[model samples]
Target: DETALGTLHSNRSAAYFAIADYANAIQDADECIRLRPKWAKGYFRKAAALVQQQRLKEGVTAYERGLVFEPTNAAMKAARDDTILLQKVKYVPYPTSVMAPAKE
Candidate 1:
């Protein structure tokens, strides 16, 4: 029952964050975390809320914490990389060696 309630709250919090409702998102994320401390997605939800509220620094930090919890999550990896890139560039980007073979 408690776990189910936590999931509902956490999912709704993610929805709220998606629509820029940081306060409510944070509220629900907080509840979710309180209810399920091992849930990685809950932290990610909280990070999204912090991001939407214009607290970029703390938001990325929270995302990093999420990575600690979900190290192999591809979406989180991309988001983390993109956030770092966003901090560095609007137009210019550091060069990266392409992984695939270059065909003429």
Candidate 2:
């Protein structure tokens, strides 16, 4: 049963993520996505691992792809929005005062 196998891969991906093993998580997520192309969970797992790796753009792309299959997924939508914000923040410069040494 391909679907069951896909579920198992997705579960493994989640386990890898829990252990902070992002590369393996992504690998398992990719397998799950290959086995179940229409399943949003695989994409979600991939996106999460990518985000943890600081690959924000790739994470956003994965989330967008998942949204195509489940447009009304609120959790995915929130995560995607948060990632977009994080990406924007990454390029923003901190205020000079924020980086200044404190006075004694």
Candidate 3:
């Protein structure tokens, strides 16, 4: 029954994420994790919601935690890699050419 409840919460979290409701998604994902600590799906949901909210560090941490339980999950690996890329891009400065005004 607890696993079933966890699944329900996980489903709700995904639905919230689909609607761009990162807050609710994260909340439900947390509930799922609480209900099923070893389940990777909950971590995936939480990571995704955190990423959507621009909480990159936390997202990456969540992904790492999930990977500890499901190291063979290709999807989670890809998502984690993408999030790392996003973090890099976020901190990269624009090229001078892009920031400069064009020739008159």
Model 3, 1-104: lDDT tens digits are 99999999999999999999999999999999999999999999999999999999999999999999999999999999999999999999999999999999
Task: List TM-scores for all candidates, in order.
Answer: 0.72, 0.91, 0.92
Superposition error at 51 for model 3 (Å): 1.0
**Across residues 26-98, which tens digit of lDDT does each residue of candidate 1 receive?**
8998899788777778878887787667666666786787788789988877776776666556446545656
Model 2 gets an lDDT of 0.99
Candidate lDDT scores, in order, read 0.79, 0.99, 0.98
| lDDT for position 57 in model 1 | 68
Error of 3 at 12 (Å): 0.6
Evaluation by TM-score, superior candidate among 1 and 2: 2
In candidate 1, stretches whose alpha carbon ends up further than 4 angstroms from where it belongs are: 89-104
Ranking by lDDT: 2, 3, 1
Cα error of candidate 1 at position 49, Å = 2.0
Q: Where does candidate 3 have its weakest 10-residue lDDT segment?
A: 60-69
Instruction: Show the lowest summed lDDT stretch of 10 residues, model 1.
Output: 90-99
Residue 69 C-alpha lDDT in model 2: 100
Q: Which candidate comes out best when scored by lDDT?
A: 2
